[model samples]
Target: MTTETPAPRHETDVTSGPGAVGAAVAAAREAQPWWAGIGFAGRKKALDAWRVLILRRADELVDVIRAETGKTADDARLEVILVADHLRWAAAHAGKVLGRRRVPSGLLMFNQSATVEYRPLGVVGVIGPWNYPAFIPIGPVSAALAAGNTVVLKPSELTPAVGQWLADTLAEAVDGPRVLRVVTGSGETGAALCRAAVDKISFTGSSATGRRVMAACAENLTPVVIEGGGKDAMIVAADADLDAAADAAVWAAMSNAGQTCVGLERVYVVSEVADRFLRLVGDRAAALRTGDRPDADLGPIVLPRQLEIIKAHVRDAVARGARVVLGGTESFTPPYVAPIVLADVPEDSVALTEETFGPVLVVNRVTCVDEAVDQVNASAYGLGASVYTGDRSQGRRIAGRLRAGMVSVNAVIAFAGIPALPFGGVGDSGFGRVHGPDGLREFTRTQAVTSQRFRPLMQPNSFGRAPGTMQTLVRMMRALYGR
Candidate 1:
């Protein structure tokens, strides 16, 4: 979850029309053969070069991202840094992780030597979301490139310039049109890409849109990885650091105007510390200012349509008897929505049940850790959750019970910063992953091979079969089974 506030009302400058989608896929098709011809090591070298380039041009890239997405330049810098780290990690580890590895043959196949290798799945189609556009798109691109596949990426309509910038920067590292290309546009363009003859489709967006992408991919039987929406939660225990938990919760919930996927949308606190946690979190949230300034901790919503949705959620909660602890509704800030915090919100309210992708958080109080875990797991979305406790064992124990792809104990949304950790979710949150070892494998297919080392004296299926071979097989089965 990169940004959390509702988006501002602004016309998109570079959304791709339906006709342009066909042209982009047509271009990708033309570049397929050359991209596939590049062997694994060669592609790895190119990816390594791209990684270096991104790192060297990190500041400039961050500025572009911040300008496009309304995030602070410093926050954008962090995004670039993580993206560079992923590129470096994928390049360095691809050879070892995806390379051919020998496997032991069982006694029945003792004469054969076996091995497994991961190979690319031709051209890859990636449909990116507006939030963290560069980092999200780069994950699939890096892995696919490292495994020797061409890529055609379609970034969100909200931020096409950054998409163009990324494609232009990456083109310098790799030759040919098929290696890395950009197709900028709206949902139709994304749908067209999915329907094209691409071997795989990687999409990161809302769960509702993810379903549409998946349905389109089904037309070609193309495998897909959907990094969909998340309604993540944070658990505050009685023994938790009220100050730290409050700070983390406020920052996680309202940063980027609380538009992060794994950000703290809902917080569950023990009854003993509920008031203290609420006061602290409310104070911090109130102190935050959202605007188009460099000093502001929060930024305007990137998409204008998001504002209506944000308004609906807050209104629904208030109508259902939830108390607004802080800012609720502000007007005409050019896509900026002030941080809103709700307490005692009903469990079934839209703010609690569904994903409120704006800068609003619903706080609930639980009697115990079990109850907290239950509330956290009650939601259909389970991308991530955080637990704050001084006792490491208690934190782990509660974390173990929470059904989420990632968990942060005594921290908030730090999992994404660590390139080594797998970033994804289970159930409705989405399938597959986009970072760590899992991300690398998501773009590669496993190929297993076997070779005969020596001829057996008595082959199981041969011109001449010995009676003793059958006897030996029977004896082995009997010995193993002990029947």
Candidate 2:
């Protein structure tokens, strides 16, 4: 974890309470080995139980998210569904991925039978962001538990109520905070959780704070997985279904109040269809609304500081000669920042370079598909990318060139919803993956074993090795590698 100051955004002050965070950390540490001792089958049973509980009471869970984040009930429901999906996937696959499996011994050790297993890495600390708290935390929490490690999760202070709800529900299904537990607080609490006696830390938040979380975890030399902010891009090819592309781009950008890490922040459209795509995108953006109302398309920014940051990016872009194709130079409403789209923006504008994290999109025009791919790849953050095209080969080519962790062709942000796909970013967008089999192994440590079933015919361990033994070994090596 770096000592550098974190970028200003929304955070909580929950760490200051009397022994609140300390007790949470102590309890989690105390219960660590107990959870780890449960073996894979035991842990899976607990996870499955919790999954059923969550599925049965999903509406209540969504209601908690709705109260804390102010997102629509539907959005909250989606979060619950994502969590349930991950829990179910982890439960169903944990055994197959982590169980000890036999492997063929290499030629050098042909007398021995080998097996490889993924073992628990003890306790895991999960520091979650307010946005998609349920889904984000569980991506790590469920996998960690399924991998047979205890977890201590610190939910964002802005949404402590949701954290409490998760803790309560898990407690009912699992035993004594062994499998899953939650701690509520601001950065200090999260930092404390990082420094707690844990083998690894998982965080989902801004890159700046992610740096801080990494630094804190480094104090214990603990490994970390960060799902940080992204300046994701969506490409619109000339042959694309303009209406579908436009709708997806708008929805991806504006969903979750544009607070999604993989939200469509930048759009690159080929000049041949730029005008038509622009009109469609603008129409979709114009029809969007931001507020606390249930019927509204989106909700307010979770943190006031986030609103300031969004406003600053928009202001900086406008000053740098960018035209606001949609809402721009918006009035402050304390929480809600209206969705905005900027066009003809300079490449160096903050709206294009930095993560606005508000309901904003910066659309750029490219002369050809090559230019479109180049523009989409020209960013420090590469979490996710989407290319809309009728040509399958062209879409795959564009996706291959974009330096992102995940890419979707003819879809906006659909890769994340797929349980089989790995999720994480490269560069400053953060590293490591969650979801799919990759995610299942992220929380596990590989343990290799070799058991000698019989005495070797050519006893290399003995000093009485005959010259014929060397000849035999050489023959074995040659036979294996010659092909």
Candidate 3:
């Protein structure tokens, strides 16, 4: 229902309404059967060719991403690289993960043979986010395509060019029907896709919007995988390496202008080392600069409305008595926002309770690591988190205690890069997974088949069984299960 148009000024306005979205889904549905019938080896070859095209034209894709999202060239390039890696991984692993496999028929059906396999859903709809536009959407798209489903991608209105570029390159790499298509518009376009007759929908955006998407999909009882907003946290222990922890905190908080869904929004440090850790973090955050310059460490805030939210969070924190360790409200200058670091922020402040989605970090001192864990788990979000400690065992123990779906020990956002790990969140952060084996299966429907090898000694399915047959079965069950 949003009316805002956030694309850059020079970009042409291109949008698709409900009619066009329906047409696209229809086309994809027609093409899906052929794509699936080709089998795993054939599909892998096509995907590999597409991967090569992505590598060869990575610079062009990077330019499109930067123009739409206002991210640095390096940041855009990293996103491209990660997307390609996921595409490659999906193409290589889909066969083993979703192919047919035999299973035991069990004692009750010993005379029958059983097998299970993952079959492609007819069509999948992907509604991607503007932040990390290429990387996030490609994860689901590639996995869906690998699992033999056609996809209709509805990119965020702010970043339609990037989505079109992906679809175009894929078409050029593989000569076939339009198995992948891009539909560009605002929330109306996205809602249309959700309500369409697609077999499944994969959505990445705010938790509030996610609820709406779920409601629309409910009309048809269609399935969905929602990856929503996050208020991620970082914990620095008393025995942690202060230098490493500070460095990780700064990069994770300030990078991408703090628009990352899994970025560090808060930090909890034990009081014993809070002073030292705060000093290191303040120094690193202060040194960072934001601008369009090639040497700048950060870029402008992409969405106009998000800028206001960032400003409000800082003002609320300061009004609530949080001490500004580095930049404050004055750091914001329209599109670009300098990194801001706050210490001893009130727990109830919006900066601490909400998803700031800006380059602001709130560091609070805790009495102990247990107290830190408690505070981190208090938030409604459970997307991702990090723990730093000199003792590896202690770090692991803390990681297990966090309520987030993904946790990194002595590292920041490390689980995202590994292709084998599932990515998603819990609570307001949303559910369902994308990446690894689970991701491959997300776009598939499980099919279990059984064949009767021979007739059973007892005809339990028959209506007229001999009286002695029932007594014999009872004795066998007692002999097998009685203790």
lDDT of the candidates, in the order given: 0.81, 0.82, 0.91
- Please rank every candidate by lDDT, starting with the best: 3, 2, 1
Ranking by TM-score: 3, 1, 2
Residue 369 lDDT (model 2): 80
Give me the overall lDDT of model 1.
0.81
The best candidate by lDDT is 3
Question: Which one wins on TM-score?
Answer: 3
1-483: candidate 2 lDDT, tens digit per residue: 111223224444433432465566667667777877777777778878888998899988988787777887778888988888888888888889889999989767788999999988877888888888788888888888888777778877777667767767888998765456677655777888777757888888888889888898899889999988899998888899999999999999999888888889999998889888889999988887667665798887777667778888889889988888888766357688777888888888888888888788888898888887777778888799999999979899889989999999999889889877889999888999899889989998999999998877678777798768877877877898878
- Candidate 1 residue 315 Cα shift, in angstroms, is 1.5
Candidate 1 local lDDT, 230-250, one digit each (tens):
999999999999999999988
TM-score of 1: 0.93
Tens-digit lDDT track of model 3 for 301-385: 8888888888999999999999999999789888899999999999999998889998999999999999999999999999999
- Candidate 2 residue runs with Cα over 4 Å from true position: 1-23, 175-177, 475-483
